[model samples]
Target: MIKIALFNHKGGVGKTTLTVNIADALADLEKSVLIVDADPQCNITSFYMDESRLEELLGESGEDGSDATVWSALKPVVEGRGDVGSITPWEMRKGIHLLPGDVLMSDYEEELPTAWTECFARRQRGYSVTTALSRLVNNNAESLEVDVVLYDVGPNVGALNRVVILDCDLFITPVAADLFSLRALSTVGRSVAKWIADWQTIRSLASPADRESIFEGLPTYGGYITSAFKVHTGRSAANPHADWEKKIAPRVRDRVVSVLGAVNPDLIPNFGGNKVGGVKHFHSLAPEAQKYGFAIGKLRGYVNPGHYATVDDARSTFAALAREIVRRAGI
Candidate 1:
């Protein structure tokens, strides 16, 4: 399976929304998809199920001594009890599965920093701790036999996210048209470069056996997706939102593509451009899709006639984005 993470160092960039709808679109294309909710906020979990169902999953352990959440699977390793345990993902749709997120996952953040330090010494326990999430994801993906695994991570450059990013085969940044999001590209670029270099050093320190056991190498830069930008009826240069889009594109090229490419040109694909796709503001249709627990295109019987066009647009937009991702990633 090709593992792709939708991430950004800045919050409110529509990462959760893109992760959900893109998975939905991929399912429509007959690809079995597994979404790993690595974010401690559990926003993607909320999108797939209601509060009562989420409570049941997170509140108590299963008969098999698991809660079927990301934290539950990694809890054993974090506490030094054992390695990651088996997790059963929830089938959100015909071809879509969700490995629900846990609010308690924030607890794992404290363990990663120490584990990362010990990795330089080639300690088995340290490697196990650091690769806990990766092992959990890979095992579950194999069991499900899914075509792709999409990760939704929180907005930060924390130690927890460092491991998550390193575990992936590729990652995409979801950005909004604003100065804050623009500036975050620099942080994302620099942090990823450092993480990849450090991971390479750690790999060099490991014995061949340890290296073989823990060797899911560095992730490459897939591309960036422009999201939550205002849609104007007319494509005029005078429009402020259009102006921001114009400005952000070159900066994305300079900050993200060039920086990562400089580190290792192979980290970026030879695709003509780095923009995978874009999503316009969905307005009320976005909330309706979330409330109904369906992609905008999948919502039926609950949407008003007035929003039909918006739904159609959203469906087509996501479908095209999914196709581009498949082509670009060679999935």
Candidate 2:
């Protein structure tokens, strides 16, 4: 199975929106999928549930249930016990299952120092933070019926983000067409670089060559996906570009592209390459997505052909990105 994560160190970059729609797009193609909401914001989780259900789930996301959330799912396995799958496949749609998150999930941050302590504990083999998360996903998940697992993560490099980054196989970056989000591309690249290095550092010290066998390899991030992309005619784009994307994209495709290529050329090639991967852009189908409280991709009519002809084109873009992922995973 492919475990894909949607993350950006920068906030307001449409990370959650891309995660939801991509899952829908994949489901349209009949691909079985799992979406884990690791973001304390739980925006993705609320989107998947009805009103009352959302309220209840949000209540559950508090300190009272943080342990029962995805964090608990990854706890070290007891001698004879197993991890719990908080998700019920049958209760989920035929092709999709969701592990929800919420706003009150901030306790995960408070719990990090304890985790740092555990990592240094010499408690047991694979008891490190990385292994704890690995064990959680592997143990708690009863069974996965799909080929892809998507994680909607928050914007940061703290405990959960670190663990999720280590556990994911593909990183789908969603950035606004603004400056701050674009500038964030550089931070994301650096974070990925460090993550890859650190994973190797830990793996090298292990006794067996396949010590990291329990976890997936740290693949270079999938190319960034631009959200709220307005018309590209250069006429202010009706709004030039968002503040975040403007500062970030160039650093990603320009400065870091070559270095990333040296490390994993297949993941992020030259922007205009023949490979199934390269930098690509996507805009919001409506004016609302660019401003306002909702994303156009979330609207029910979003799938209608007229509303998203670009989706057809973007699908090819992401499909290539997906192909790059499969190729790297040796699938």
Candidate 3:
């Protein structure tokens, strides 16, 4: 199964929105998809799951060993008990499941880095600590026949993200049309390069058999999606105005190629093809969909006819994005 992380070290770039909506679109296409909310904030989990149910799975009274979150599967490894045991993902639908997120996940930030150092010693704790998520997904994917695994991570270069990034097969970045996003391109690019190099160095010290114990190398740059490009007002539909894509698109192309090309020149992103469609601001439809747990595209007549166009726009845009991601990531 192909694993893709929808990440950006910048907030408000529609990262979780794209993860939730695009995965919904992929499920619409009959693909078995699993969304792992790696973000400690658990916004993606809240999007697809009921708050009460989520609380029961992560609350104090519910913090028993039976809790089924990404954090639950890592608790043993983080405590240096042993390898990760079977991960029981919460079923969301027929083909879509959720390995929910917990607020307590932040506790692993310090633990993972310490484990990384121990990994060079070929200790089982290090292997279990570093490979918990990968082992969970890999073990589940084969039996579940999952087509794709999508991850939603918070916007940061933290220790928890390091483990997630190192384990994935590919990463799909979501950025906005702004200077901050342009700057984050550098942050993500350099950090990923350093992580990959450091992991390789650690693996080099291990014997041949133990070398395979390291988590998968840093995920390849799958592509980028530029969100919040156009500012929508009541009259935007009547009179179209210039969007940020024109000014920011070239910079995105240049920065991605310059930073990531050093590793794989052929994988340099092409703006024309790699650019997923600019997602339209769905305004009220998004919050409404989240409230009712409906896919923005399929939000049935919960609103007036006037807002139908926006819902349709959100539906079509994410559907196109889902297809683009599948093609680019080769899922």
Candidate 4:
């Protein structure tokens, strides 16, 4: 299975939205796929659920051990159980399933780093999140013939994000083109680059006794995607505006590649830019809220509720994004 993390450390960059919509597009292709919402906000899960289940899932409920919490699943990886494959997916469709996120996932930001620092940490124990996720999805892919695993990570680049990216074979980044986001694009890219570098450096430093126990197989970063490039309202869509087609395209394309260029050739994630039509949807509070899973229906009552594609002139941009991912991943 081709595993990829749709991540950016900056919020408001359409990470979860891209995760849900693109995975849905892959479902349209009859590809068996699973989306693991690692974000604590759980926005991706809320979109699939109505308001009622959101309340229950987000609440501090019982620890009867029957219930599935994202936090509890991390335990098998944290201890020396070497068990990362037991968690089952919550089915959403014939081709698509989800491992829902809980608010407790936010705490992982602090826990993963500390766990990795411990001397007793095992290969699977040090990075429970990835090992478990990899094991679960890898097993499912082989047994059930699934095609992909996509992770929707929270807006942090600590050990959890590091582990997730490490395990992934591809990365489709969702980013906004604002000044802050552009800066974030560079910073996050550098962080990911350094993360891979850290793995090799640590591997070399490990004593013969500690090497196998501490470092699991090293992770690789595949290509990335930049989503939701804003369009100026007054710009002419009547024809290919020379400015947008020529001048704007190259700069935007370069922005993504520039950051990822200087890393381990095979290990550095490739950044291929893509667009989500977020600007047109931003005007209506209902559309904005629905995108974030704060509402049940479309921004315009006339728009079909289940039709959640990132529609631009009625074209599903997300489907194109999914196709691009499948092609680039060579799946």
Residue 197 alpha-carbon offset, candidate 4, angstroms: 0.8
The worst-scoring run of ten residues by lDDT in candidate 1 lies at 229-238
RMSD of 2: 5.8
Candidate 3 lDDT, 123-166, residue by residue in tens: 76776677777777677777688999888899999888888888
Q: RMSD to native for every prediction?
A: 2.6, 5.8, 3.3, 5.5
Q: After superposition, how far is residue 306 of candidate 2 from its true place, in Å?
A: 9.5
Best-performing candidate as measured by lDDT:
1
- lDDT of each candidate versus the true structure: 0.86, 0.56, 0.75, 0.58
Q: What is the TM-score of each candidate against the true structure?
A: 0.95, 0.70, 0.89, 0.73
Scored against the true structure, residue 10 in model 2 reaches a CA lDDT of 76
Q: Give candidate 4's whole-model lDDT.
A: 0.58
lDDT, residue 162, model 2? 72
Task: List the pairs of residues colliding in candidate 1.
Answer: none
Model 4, residue 176: displacement in angstroms?
Answer: 1.6
* Better model by lDDT: candidate 3 vs candidate 4: 3
State model 3's lDDT: 0.75
Candidate 1 per-residue lDDT, tens place, 1-331, comes to 8999988998878888888899999999999999999888999999989999998988863334685699888888888988888887999989999999988788888899999999998887889999999999899899999999998999999998999899888899887876688789999998998898899899999998888888566788888898884333345456655666787778878888888888788898877887888898988877888898989887656788888788889899999999998987789
Ranking by lDDT: 1, 3, 4, 2
lDDT of 4 at 148: 86
